[model samples]
Target: MSISLEQVHPLIGNKFQIETSNGIMHLELVEAEERPRRGVPESFRTPLLLIFAGSSRQPLAQDNYFIEHPSLGKQVWTIAPTLADHAKGQYQRPHEDGSTCLYYQVFFN
Candidate 1:
């Protein structure tokens, strides 16, 4: 199944179990950008983008870069997905309140 931001709303504020190739992955969406602040404060909080490659055993890591958009001005916090040693798996984003915002079941073969 494909995962999208709108598909996981039910799991937005809660922790849920994600079935992955490696095992059941526990994910929680912690939080999203609470409010927007004015002025350039050097940085701004961007929506969390979580990418999970089922076979990865180590901690997921990625670099967050920034770009300036004509409408949004400065766009920051880009989630770069770096796949681990394995292929084919599941991914999801769960919120602290037991809601999930995104989920995907991928098959690599």
Candidate 2:
């Protein structure tokens, strides 16, 4: 079965594995959920944000991968590099070592 955004929202702060050509890599759902659309009604269509975090060991700069979740099953997601707005400090994820990590954002209709 395919996985939906709603099925992933609740899994925030949890880890999920991705099947890659190299091997199995893992990532954590740092953020998820739909943001209130500017003009669209709350029930109509809200923007969804599926952000995943990974360490230097796992690189997601390649193509899409198949993500497998116990409840959500497996689904393919194309991840892209997301730049954290410097103006919006809240969107930034800083590490203890002063190195900011990379965050991949997935968009789906």
Candidate 3:
């Protein structure tokens, strides 16, 4: 089944796992933003932007991954490595986890 913005919005800040050939990488959903409406105006489901943060100590390749959540089940999505903030640098995640790392984003549009 396709994942919708509504299904994931509430799960922000929760832990999610990404399955890669290297192994399982742990990540946290850090940001969610509703994108501008498209297609059938407001009647259509708005696109969404979801950002996830992972450990900076390890390397995370950009690829399609099967993301697993405790309650959200499993869904595959294409995730690309992105900057947390251009001014601040892309690799370091802007979180208070006492550690900084690279951030990844998934586009629902």
- What is the TM-score of each predicted model, taking all chains together? 0.24, 0.69, 0.77
Looking at model 1, which ten-residue stretch has the lowest summed lDDT?
100-109
Rank by lDDT (best first):
3, 2, 1
On residues 31-106, what C-alpha lDDT tens digit does candidate 1 reach at each position? 2222323453545342223433222232223433342223224433333344322232223433334443332222
* TM-score of candidate 3 to 2 decimals: 0.77
- Is candidate 1 or 3 superior in TM-score? 3
Per-residue lDDT value at 32 in model 2? 77
The 10 consecutive residues of candidate 3 with the worst lDDT sum are 88-97
Candidate 3: how large is its RMSD?
A: 3.3
Top model number, TM-score: 3
lDDT of 3: 0.78
Against the unseen true structure, what C-alpha lDDT does each candidate score? 0.34, 0.70, 0.78
Better of 1 and 2 by TM-score: 2
Candidate 3, residue 61: Cα displacement in angstroms equals: 2.0
Kindly report which residue stretches of model 3 are placed more than 4 angstroms away from their true locations once superposed. Answer: 38-44, 86-99
Candidate 3: tens digits of C-alpha lDDT, residues 20-98: 8878878888778887775647655678898888887655777888999978788898989887766645554445556
